[model samples]
Target chain A: MDKRAIGVFDSGLGGLTAVRRLHALMPQENIIYFGDTGRVPYGTRGRDIITKYARQDVAFLRQFDLKSIIIACNTVSAIALDLLSKENDIPIIGTVEPACRRAMTMTQTGRVGVIGTAATIRSGAYEKYLHKKDGTLDLFTQACPLFVPLVENGRVHRGDVVIETVVKEYLTPLKDAGVDTLILGCTHYPLLEEVIGDFMGPDVTLIDSGAEAANLASTQFDPNEGTGTTQYFVSDDPQGFNQLAELFLQEKVDVGAELVDISRY
Target chain B: MDKRAIGVFDSGLGGLTAVRRLHALMPQENIIYFGDTGRVPYGTRGRDIITKYARQDVAFLRQFDLKSIIIACNTVSAIALDLLSKENDIPIIGTVEPACRRAMTMTQTGRVGVIGTAATIRSGAYEKYLHKKDGTLDLFTQACPLFVPLVENGRVHRGDVVIETVVKEYLTPLKDAGVDTLILGCTHYPLLEEVIGDFMGPDVTLIDSGAEAANLASTQFDPNEGTGTTQYFVSDDPQGFNQLAELFLQEKVDVGAELVDISRY
Candidate 1:
């Protein structure tokens, strides 16, 4: 039995969805979360920048003496996970692999749809993983870059005209491609599930990346009582981070967030 | 006559709108631009984070021996410009004061509206400046955070249903408030000008923050030969930076962008 905290991080507060799930599954395991609030929305950026930021994020969590690290941002999970694992000694898990495995299991028709940030979709990480698992599966990918900012700004709802219209535009291509299962490729996309569900109709199955990652974390749980306390850190704006935590966890957590110079990591 | 480059920066590619104008207005002046592409969307973040990132951006540009600096991001200009200026020796200009000054001049009915990122609106910098300029003028403000990500991803045509719908949702409140003039308080908002114009109606004048900052940059122009060239630097993907540059400038520029370690600053 060991008691080290589980380290989870994302480009922003979206990763709290995973933290929320982890809390439910492993109630006693401590968590250390770092959201790069200052430089967020990592999905639309280039591969090199995403990799650099991911390394810094992992390094920040490493300082907490974490037993394992979870790269919760889909864009980073897709592009930088392999590089990060090679650089760190701890057990590292990214949202992409576990979510892809879950999607493969859920899909009966072997046809899948993926929606994420421009960079994540462009990386073809999901498609690559799915193809490696079954070589015959069909993949449809769409880049919904605006989804992150829209959800973060609290414009997510089934009846919200603006978000509804944008969701329709983004999902139309995927729906037309005739996929039976859709992966909410980015963690933030889960917040817009109601809007996405309305647009995709009832036939499509939705996969949540954060939920899958949480499931994976539960399987690898090391039951130890001494090291399971949760801690939170941010690169910028602790107040804004606290506010977004409410949306992800569906509860307000009053963790006095500390700002650290992320560049040094 | 100074031969040093005029340094300009933003949290991301939004500042390219100002750089585009500067290129047209002063063909001979050297330009050094830095866009923190990896950690962008500074408008939604908090003030302290914006200040820290802005300082690093400024310090990164200082390596080029810049004669002047322009903070083309409205959120940063509103919250961190004074702090950033005090941290650097170079002459610094920000979009807020220039855009606010222009808005004060353009409003005929004494009722002006401002739309920007949440942080910019929350700071109330434009409202304070407009009131200071003419106490009788009425100010209305709203935060349209998704506009930047939408513009960055190129969903910005007047005929684009998604953009038009989002624009309507963002502008309906300001339109109801009955303001004769509106400030596009963020530099990225200029890309959505056509959609915003259709939503707000032609009667309400729109102020482009980047254009105002460009006009301000013109006032500091030095008439020296061969010292003016555009040099671009970024913290992350130079390829994504160049692509965004094409969208904001609408003209292809062969800008050889170099990557810099911005967190050090």
Candidate 2:
């Protein structure tokens, strides 16, 4: 049984949703989370830059004796996970494969809709993974570039006009395709589930990638071995991250985040 | 007479607005622009991180024999201008001082409104600069955090429901305060001028800080010194910047952007 802490990182606080789920599933496992708040919103950026930042994020976590590393960010997972897994010895798992697998099981109609940042949708990572599992599976993909900013700005309420308008603009195409299973392809996308779900109607099943990834991590480790310790680290102002932590985790972050100069990595 | 190119940089393509204005005011001036596209949107980040990025942006421009340097991004101008100006021997000018000066001359009622990113409004740089100039002047400031993302996503058309809703939400406070002159404090705001202008109505004179900064730069040197050459540089994928350049510059960005590894700075 590996007793070491599990390392998790995201472009920003969105990864904490995964951590919250991880805590629920494996209460005793020690978790160390790093949010790259300084250089965030990786979904809108280029693949190479995201990959570079992901490497730095992994290196920062590698300093700790981690049982495993989770790429909680969908953007990093889509763009950098293979490179990171190949380069490092530690077990590195990205959200895409786990969540795709979850969707494959959840979908009865073989019709799946994937929504994420531009790079993620453009990379077609989710579709590729799903196709590899079953070539007959039908996939519809949409890039909701503004979703991250909307979520980050706390505009995810049920009746928010802006959120509703933007959501409709992105999801209508997927809905038109008659996709029964919708993948919240970005970590931050889960925060806007209520609005997205309302638009997609009650009949459609919404898959939370971060939560699925957490569940995937749960199966890999022995729950009885850990100490239940959790620490938060960020590359920007701790004060700001501390204030926004609750928005992501759905509870006040117990420990104040410690700031680290991530550029050093 | 300085024959060297004038340097201008922003966290992203928003500074191209300043470059566009510079081209108009001084048609013959050679301009060198650097947009940190890899790590754009510094306005939402902490002061120290903004300062660090501003330094790297300046250092990248300093490599060329520059006649002067312009901090076209309002966030960097608000947070790092004074520090950057003091640290470097080259003439460094930020948009705040020039825009504030312009507003001073334009406002007949002495009531001025300022709108920008969270960091810019939080820093109170425009208010401080305006107050320092005339203590009796009344100022109303609002932080429009979503504006940058909206503009970057190309949601700037007049009567666009999302743009109108966001504009009203951010501008109503300023409009209620009865400010006749409004300062588009951030460079990106100028792109949404039509939507913003419609919301504020015809009487409220909108001030583009970026345009004003370009005018200010034009006055500092002889027009005949430059050869009408302009070049663009970015920290991330040039192809992405190349696609978005026209949105900011109004015209085609001739000679595609050159990539620079900004972390070295």
Cα lDDT tens digits, model 1, A123-215, are 989988988888999998998877888888788877777788888888898889888899998989889988898888888899999889988
> Model 1: per-residue lDDT, tens digit, B1-265?
7888888999889998999888878878888899887678788777777777888888788878878899989988999888878878878999988888888888888889999999899999998888888899989899987788778768888677767877887789889988989999998998888888888888999999988898888887666576457888888888768766888888877677888878777
Interface RMSD of each: 1.8, 0.7
What ranges in model 2 sit over 4 Å off? Answer: none
- Model 1 residue runs over 4 Å out of place are A222-228, A252-256
Clashing pairs in 2: none
Chain A alone, model 2, TM-score? Answer: 0.98
The CA-based lDDT of model 1 is what? 0.85
Summarize candidate 2's per-residue lDDT along B88-156 as a digit string, tens digits.
988998999999999999999999999999999999898888888899999999999999999999999
Error of model 1, residue A49, in angstroms: 2.1
